[model samples]
Every structure is written in structure tokens, then in C-alpha cells.
Target chain A: MRRTRPPSPTSAGPATREGRRTWGTRTAAPTAGIATFEAGGWRLEAVGYSLRPAAHTEPPMKTRAVLSAIGPDRPGLVAKITDFLLARGGNVEDSRMAVLGGDFAVILLFSVDSAGFETIMRDRERLAAETDLALVLRRTEARAPQDEARLLWQVKAVALDHPGIVHRLSEALAQRGINIVEFESHVAPAPVSGTPVFSMEAAISVPASVRAADLRAALARIGDEECVDIDVRPDA
Target chain B: MRRTRPPSPTSAGPATREGRRTWGTRTAAPTAGIATFEAGGWRLEAVGYSLRPAAHTEPPMKTRAVLSAIGPDRPGLVAKITDFLLARGGNVEDSRMAVLGGDFAVILLFSVDSAGFETIMRDRERLAAETDLALVLRRTEARAPQDEARLLWQVKAVALDHPGIVHRLSEALAQRGINIVEFESHVAPAPVSGTPVFSMEAAISVPASVRAADLRAALARIGDEECVDIDVRPDA
Candidate 1:
């Protein structure tokens, strides 16, 4: 049997509130199979079946996959998906979901034991048909650790809606061997003028050989050519 | 056969470059199926086989679906996906993709004629098996227009790592009937201390009945209780 440790008593840190009386308090005494904490009048109470201590042996190697699903937006979509995963001993490690247009679109990273993973994979087609969802799944392995020496930059651009803006910018970055980490874009009406404006935000990693000034200049040149306002800054 | 108009000559807008000569010139003459424009020393050139005229009959309604796929990171993943879609008379309307860890994960919004859509949907299983991708698909319909009166706000928070942070904040918003439009969260090391810190950015819609001041106060209270720095501002 694996023994579990009690929750740590250390305060996360001081609250930002001014003139507030500070007290590190645990309102609910932690019993076995339970843990709780409190600070600055707020409480975090959790109940767990087991919490492993350090130096635990490695358990079964689980399979990881990315799942994307879309269906009519409704209240029970998330609960239904999670329930299915939970029943199969799978856990969602990361996920994002939104109601896009009239549909709920979700993407999740999940892990499960071999048996559970196989079951999910084999049943996917039936799952899609039964759930009335369009589903996409991709098996994944551990990601390579990010290169620390690469400088990360946040790029933002706003311009009148037009074609090839993203292509032009991405081409420029690719020429410099910059790696794009995250990207998002949308079209919204401009304030006052109400003209449709395209806005994009991207996180890109610059190789050490590239000078920040040169990169900025290159982006400025593209902005000038495309009549877009582009801002480049170090990501926080 | 369909006829395409030459690309439009309208200038997107003026460039931000200072003291540059302003000339709206057509450097490349418009050919039968080509259109081009130049302003502030930048040019946009496009060639098309067919551009729909304003007074055209309704074409076949296209089926739209959201596709999510992940595969081992490589040079041709996107090209392969796009090629597959194009061969089926499909178009990718919007997409976001990133190399996460060692895997390339992508989500695309695409549309195809009914026959092509059916073909793609039927071939999904084979596609996954042959391509070695985890895939998720969701068919979608036109989304209802957004409510213009809903006040949009951007919320950002940063704090020490802890469970229940997101749950607590989301619960507060949910109680007030606020709808989250978009949300993203990530964990990164603090600059000086190297402590793992959690950061979140979200866009939410507030019902007109909810006062902005009250919302801010509620968020502040949660931040105070949780020892997190929260910022609420109107989204542009």
C-alpha cells in the first residue's frame, strides 16, 4: 500500500489586499484521504483518495493523445466527455473549449493506461456517430524540451482585412528560422470607423543568431509594405 | 465555366513609414485574371481563376467541419493535410497550429461541398490509421450572430501555483451568468525566484444587468483571497 502525506501548511504567500489582517489558517483539519488550506480569509478544501509522496515507484506507462471534438453547443457536452474519459481511467491534462459560432469546439490533451487508450481508439468512430460530433484524435509522445537559449517574442498586428497578411509575415519569420509557438487571429470591426480589421497575436522563438533589432526592422518593413501596424516585443 | 474578375485596385491603407513618398500605383498591369495594387512602396498581387460576382446565383451549400489532428513533428504535415482537403474540393477557412513538445498539433475550420464532405468523413478512419494521427472532427452549422449589447472584457491573473484557482474564478463568473468567450492558461517559472507561476488570460461577456464595478470588485475580492494579481479591463 502507498502511504500518503498530509497537505503542507506553508502559506502560498501574502495577499495583495492592503490593511488586511493576515492569518495562516486551515479551517478544515486534514484527515487521511483529505487535505485543505486557507489564507487571507479564502479557503481551499480538497478530498483525494490518495496523494503520493516523493520517491514513489513509477506506475503503468500511459498513452497520451490529443482529442478535438465539435458538436452543437449545449450544457452537458463537457460533462459527457469527461464522464466518458473518467470511466475509462483517462485524465485530461490540458484542454480548451469554446462556443464558436453555433458549435462547441474543444481540444484536449489526455492520458490513459494502455487498455483504456486502446478501448477509446477502437471505439472512436462509434463514439463520433453516437455522440453526433466530429472528432479528431492524434496520439502524442513527450514533447522535446524547449530550447532555453532561444529568445521568445510576442508579435501583434492590426490592419484592414486583406488576404496574405499572415502568409507574408510567416514567410518573413520562416526565412529567419524562427519557430512559431502559439498563434491566434480574428477579424473584428474597428472602433469608430467600423471597418473590418484583422488582428493577430503570435508567440515566436528567435534563434540566438538573429539580432532583435534586425528582426524588428524586418517586421517593420513588412508592416510598411502591408499597411499594417505590427508590434514586436519580448514575451513576458 | 466560371469567370473571374481581375483583382481590385483599392489600396489597403497608408503605411506607418514616416516621410515616405505616397504613390498609389499599379506596378503590374491587371491581366485578364490577375489583380494588383501598390501603396507606400508595398504591393499586393493576386491571380485567381474565378472570383464570384456580386449578382450570382447561390452555389451549392458547403458542409463545414472542425478538424483537429496531431502527428509527429515534420516538415510536410500541414501540406499533407491541406493537400488532402484541396483534392476533395475543401477549403480551410481558419486554423491554428503549433509544435507542442515534439508533436505538431493543428485545428482547422474547413468547408466542402456535400459529396466531398461525405467522402472525407467516411475516409477519416483510414486517414488516421495511415497518417498515424490522433484526430477529432466536429461538424458545424452557421453560428448565431453575437449579441451586440453584451459587454466584453479581458481578464488576466497571475499567481503562485495551486489547485482550485481556475475553478474558484470560473465559479464566481458562472454564478453571475457571465459567459466566457475565450480562455487560456499556462505555467511558467517566475523570473527571479524561479517559482512556478500560473498565468491566465480570458475574454468574457458580461450581461448588461451586471455592473462593471461590481464585477471588478468581485474579481478583486477573489484575487485578494487567493493571493493572485488580477487585472480586468475592457477588451479592444
Candidate 2:
């Protein structure tokens, strides 16, 4: 539920009375001339005190790219990868790199405007050839404004540790015309017994026709059939 | 904005039909002997059959703990930390450990039961005291539950990357009586210019009285005062 309103500048009462200002009025006055008005309460002595809105400047468009690299873990791996992007007209946006099972994997989201990206992607093929690393590149489109109506259901499943659990559940959701916006899965040892346990967290969008209760029931059924425990709840 | 609905299972055609079958409903009725039925197009004959509703049993409650560690970057850190959990009556649920700017930082969500948690929490202090590591314990009650609201608003600030951005924004939300369910923030390289950028993703609950527009306006003001760019949108 509803929690009590905390102390804030916008909240009513004494808090609002202390040097408070309206949103528009905060920026309306020139930053340099604010001291004069502060001396006298709301008295304007100057005539040309007109406020001009700041110029609207849109950020430059940049190319979006996805890159993946796999190789033996080594020192300066990230530095070398970043240097590659810097050599081109590219900038790394988001990246998740890890060394799992003795193999290094790197997934990067980057953007660039320089035309040299094509050449870099072609040249980096040699890294894979020489160092036993694999690299792939794909241009990505700008992410559209995400529609909120679809991101409603949050699903979690727990079961005995096993492979292909993620694939099965994801395939089931896809079959039901659901889209997963975010997902995380892991296998952890049981706290007391030391048995391995698998758990997954997924944020999904369900069609209006698919009632939440029905989806939960169906997931529960699937969990039972697969010997797991599933919890589906709305994700704000 | 309502979109067109995809086709349903029944609407797809007869191939998607689902039919229920009962035991002993088919074949020559046991002439005072055994009964038989066909399930999944397979012949099933039995002297007796029982039907039961599928139910999933909850796993035994496990004691959960959270650990924090910070140290100089080194190899085998994960193995050592995980081996510690394994040795104790604990399991690592989820963890985000990284080496940023030559310093390794780890935040792990883990669990242990009534078996040997006390000893682990006690012994873990030695690790923190002896090394640059820092460990903390968080029980299950300290963990926030997944919010059940469907709409999520993600607020991000980007300008010159600086500290205290998260603290200020979180304090603002806390002051406004908003509940933050989940949050993540990082300093990212700029997408186009290679400049430093600060980004934050917060899943928050907006009460009915507090419109999204108002929240955005408030955040925009904060961004202006702090010389940062703020983007507030639903977390689809």
C-alpha cells in the first residue's frame, strides 16, 4: 500500500515554505541576476529581465553495433578490445565480459559514426586466427521507445539443478506469444543440504486475453510436470 | 495503444486440438478382469488406476545470506570465495563481481541454513579483517520482495560522470514517498564521443496521486541543477 508522504520540498506545509520555488520559475530567472531579487521579496527592479528558453540541440546520431569475442583469458584483453574500438570511430556503450570454464567471452554494445568500423571488423578476424579467438560483429538498430503495456508479468522458477531449463521455459513462453524483456538464471547449491538448485527470473509480457491467474496456473502445471516450483507475479 | 492480437491456439487449426482421456474408457471392458484405455494414442491396460491432481511442493526454507568483498584485482578470487561458501552451509544465489579501475568489488547474494550459518558469518569476519575484503550478512527479511505493479519507470542521468548522483536521486524518491524496488547505476563511456557518462536504472512504484509527468518534471529539474541529462521512461 500507501506509505505516508515523507518530508520533501514539494510536500505541503513548513517544508514548502523554505526558499521554495516553482519548477518553471526556478530556471526563468537568469542565474547571474538572482541575488538582486533575493534582497527584496519578489520585487523586480530591472526592465530587460526577460528569460529565453535554452536552444534545443539534439545529440548527433551514431551507429550501433554488437560485438562478441571468445578466446583464452589474458591480461589486457579488455584494453586491447577497447583500443580496437577507439582506433575506429567507435565507442563502447554496454559490455558484459566474463571468463567461464577457462574460456573468455565478451559481449559489447557499441556505437560509432566513423566509416572505419567495417575495416576494423574485417581486420580483427586475424585475432581469432592467431589467438584462437572468435569475433563477430552486427550493426544494431536504435532501440525504439519501449512500450510499457507489455511488461507486466514477472516469472521465477526453482527446481533441481539441470540443463536446458532456460531453453524449455523460454520456448514455452515464445510458443504462447509472450515476449521476455529480461531474464537471469543460475544454479546454486542448496543452503543446508548442499544439493544443487536452479533458479530463474524472467520479466515477460502477456497478452490481455491471457489472464495472470491462468498463466500462473499453467506455469505451475509445467513446474509440476518438470518437478519444479514456479512463481509468476506482476512486475511494476 | 492497443495492438492487433496474434492468432490463438484454437484459431490456428485442428492440429492444435487438445483432448482429455480417462482410464478404462476404451477397449473391451475387462470382462470381469482387467480394464484398458488409450492415452496419447497408446494402449494402457491396468487392473486399477488412480487419478491425482498435480501439485508442486515447496522446497525447505533455506537460510540466505549476502556478502560484500572489495580487494585488489587478482585471479582465482571467484573460486576462493565460492569455495568458502561451499565449505560452509551456504550457496551463492546471484553475484556481480567485477574489477573496476584496478579494484575488485563483489556483491553476492547467497544463502545458508540453520546448520552452520553462525560459524560462517563469524569466520567470514576474519577474511574481511585479514584482507582488503569487506563482507556483510543480509538475511531473507532484508531482501525486498518483487513488486507486483506492472508499470516501471527507469530514470537515468548522464552529463559529466560524477559521484553522489545515485544518492541524491534515491533521497529524492525516498523523500517523495516513492518505493524503489530495484536499482542499478554505472559510469559508462559515452556512445558517440567517448566522454564519461552516468547511467541509472531504477524500478520504482508511482502512486496514483503521483503522475509520471510530475515525476519526470521533478527529475528533469534535478538534472538541470546537477548539470546532467535525465531520461525517465517506463522499463519495458
Candidate 3:
């Protein structure tokens, strides 16, 4: 991706404009050097391919695995699973576990030598007989050590709470090949109006060729169509 | 991910074991499937890559980006940045923003049309001039649509507070090729004794070839030496 933005020095338009049938109906900020561009099917690909299991790809290190289980939360659940791992020689490295609404959920990472790796595979059946754990195992690779240059940004929206606001915007973005990394939503009462207010935040990655202006215009289009106010910022 | 832990026909051993030498010393359970294996430099690589920025490769979406900034907490920080994005036609989507201590931090995702993208690139400078934002931008790619078959697991360790607990454990797992996806640590005073206690949890991915038995042995070594109790569970 070019570090510098393409130059288009259009005289800044008035800080305000009207809503229209297009992405940016209102031109609150005048175009300084560049004119508003339309969002479309145009895109560019850098083509860097990396698979997961990345964490353990380095030869000398053994492999890593993720374990998660949700079942009746009880005292023995933790002990039972830990026992199985210890019995099978699985090393506990990291994890997040908790009990919610009477059900315990466990998420953790661990490793074993190649030999134990095979043994543990067979232990699955043994585990079933010994305990009642809904278990899922995933193999993950460690990421390679090369860093690629990329652009990051933050986006947010707020309006009267409504259904599908997230879906509408996200689906629209996804239709244009956008990636949503992190997202959150909340509804709170407006202090004066006492009306419910809905807000959302998301972290996304922009590819090299896509222009931020084009993305902004697209969001504006959605904002206008959906009756929500949208905002974007260069996350520093 | 499997929905349940594998079944093991092996009979249960005594609930208690002795390990004065270090973690799990007593052979409470007999070796059934295999004997204790050594942890070493055995590794394998299966490359399956999915790149971000899959948008251009697929349809009409522009690239997404992640933006983050943390500074003195105050009003208008959000307004200033969002205004910049709107001015440049940047679109807002998903984000995670919050206030902590006396600092306000915001991270969000957004997109732009190709033309708007360029305009916002220039707006970065305008953003800097118009506001006091310690910002960082990143280009991100959309993940390919493919279901990766994997083995996921969980790992945990707890004991009296110590400086190198996380380091020693992580380094050891790294050598074994374990990839830790998530990690959390905390120090709390024991209820009765008021002694400081350290605990950690992590999610990890294990390669298909790695053995859980071998991994456990490695953890046993660390736990013994580091004086920490550790546990592992199959995550469903």
C-alpha cells in the first residue's frame, strides 16, 4: 500500500450539504484536494498467504492446541479435565475459564511432545467414559515472524436503538470486501430524552489499494439510509 | 473441534500422588497407552494460508482498517476524529472504545471508496493538525472463507506469586511448539492467610502430530522447578 494518499486538491466544499441518493449526500466538509469518489467493485490484492497453526510452525517447538468445554458447572469439572490432561501428559500453558448461568465454560491452550500428542488422541474415548465434558479440540499454528505494512482504523455509530443496524452496515461492508476484526454494541438511555440509544464500535483493516475516502462515503450512504450517525477515525 | 472429550477405558488411579521432587511425582496412574516421552526438537509444517484483503480478490468491497488512539480523557476527542473521517468520507463500522484511569482510548474499523481512501490519507495530516491524537493505522485483509480442521485445548497454572512464572512456562511451551492464543494473569491475596497468589490461563492450538503426554511432562518439569500447580482441559 502507498504510504501517501493520492492527491486531488479540490477547493474545500462547504462544511455542510444535503442527504442524497448517493453515499455522501451531505458534504459537511469541503473537498480540499480530492473530490468525493464513489464506492464500487474496484479493488487491489497484495497476495500474502499465511495459515494458522502458525504459532507452532517453527520446527523445534512442539504443537499447540486449544481446548474448550461447556457443561454442567460444578466442582469436579475443572478437576476432571485437568486430571485428564495431566494423566495424558498434556501441559497446561494458558486458559480462560468460568461458570456462567449454571454452566461452566473452559477455554485453554496446551502442548505435548509428538508422542504424547498421539496418545492424547486416543485418550478422547477414555475421557468420554470418565467424565461428561462437551469437548472441542483445535490445532493452531504459530504465526511466522514477518511483519507486513497495513492500515488500521476505528469506526463507530450511534442512533435510536434498532434491530439489524449492525447487520445492515456490516453486511454492506462485507459485500465490498471489508474485514471486521473487533466489534461491540451497547444501548443506554439518553440523559434528557430518556430514550434508548444504541452505539457500536469496530476495528477493521484496510488493504493497500482501497481508499479511506471511498469507505467513508459508503458508510455515509448507509448512515443516511439507516437513520444512524456514523463516524470514523485514524486510530493512532 | 470435537463436541466431547475422547473416551478412555483406562481405570482411575488413586486420587492422590506424591511429588516432593516437583510437580506430580507419584505415579498415581499407570502408563497405559505409552510411557513418558522426552520433549525435544521434533517438528512438522503443513502450510495452508488465507490472506486478508480478500475483498479485492472476491467482490466490490474496499479495504478495512483499524485505528487506535489513547490520550488524556476529555470531550471532543471522539468528535474531532469522527469529524475528520466524515470530512474525508471515511466510513465507520465496528469498534471497541473505552475510558480507563484518566485516559480515553478508542479503536474502530471503517472503509472508504478508492477515491475517498486517498482523500482520508491526506486527512491524516489534517487530523494531526486539527486534534491531539496519538494515533496508529493498520491495513487488514479479510479472512478467506474456509473451515480449518483443528485441535483446540486449554491450559492453566496457579501458585504463590512469582516473577518468572509466566515467562518460564511460556518459554518452555514455545520450545515445544505450543501456540498460546490468549493469556490472562492475576495476583490476589489468599482469603485466610493473606498470602499473594498468582494464577494464569491460556488458550492454545496444538499441531496434529504433537503429543499431549509429552507436553504435560514439560509442564510437570516447570511446575516442579517453578513451584506452581498447573492444569489442562480439553476445550469443547
- RMSD for each of the candidates: 11.7, 20.8, 32.5
Q: Ten-residue segment with the worst summed lDDT in candidate 3 chain A?
A: A42-51
- Best candidate per lDDT, number? 1
Per-model C-alpha lDDT, please? 0.66, 0.53, 0.53
> Which model scores highest in TM-score?
1
**Taking chain A of candidate 1, what TM-score results?**
0.68
Rank candidates, lDDT, best first. Answer: 1, 2, 3
Candidate 3 stretches with Cα past 4 Å from truth are A1-236, B1-59, B74-120, B125-131, B142-149, B186-199
Q: lDDT (0-100) at residue A148 of candidate 1?
A: 46
**How many clashes does the backbone of model 3 have?**
137
Off by over 4 Å in 2: A1-60, A126-131, A143-148, B1-236
In terms of DockQ, the best-performing candidate is 1
Give me the runs in candidate 1 sitting further than 4 Å from their true place. Answer: A1-67, A75-98, A108-140, A145-149, A171-177, A208-236, B1-65, B74-99, B108-139, B145-149, B171-177, B208-236
Residues B77-171, model 2: lDDT tens digits: 45456556666656555544444333344544556665657778777876665544544444433323334443556666666654345445655
TM-score of each: 0.58, 0.40, 0.34
Give the DockQ (2 decimals) of all models: 0.18, 0.03, 0.03
Clashes of 2: 3
Question: Which pairs, if any, clash in model 2?
Answer: A236-B149, B63-B112, B64-B111
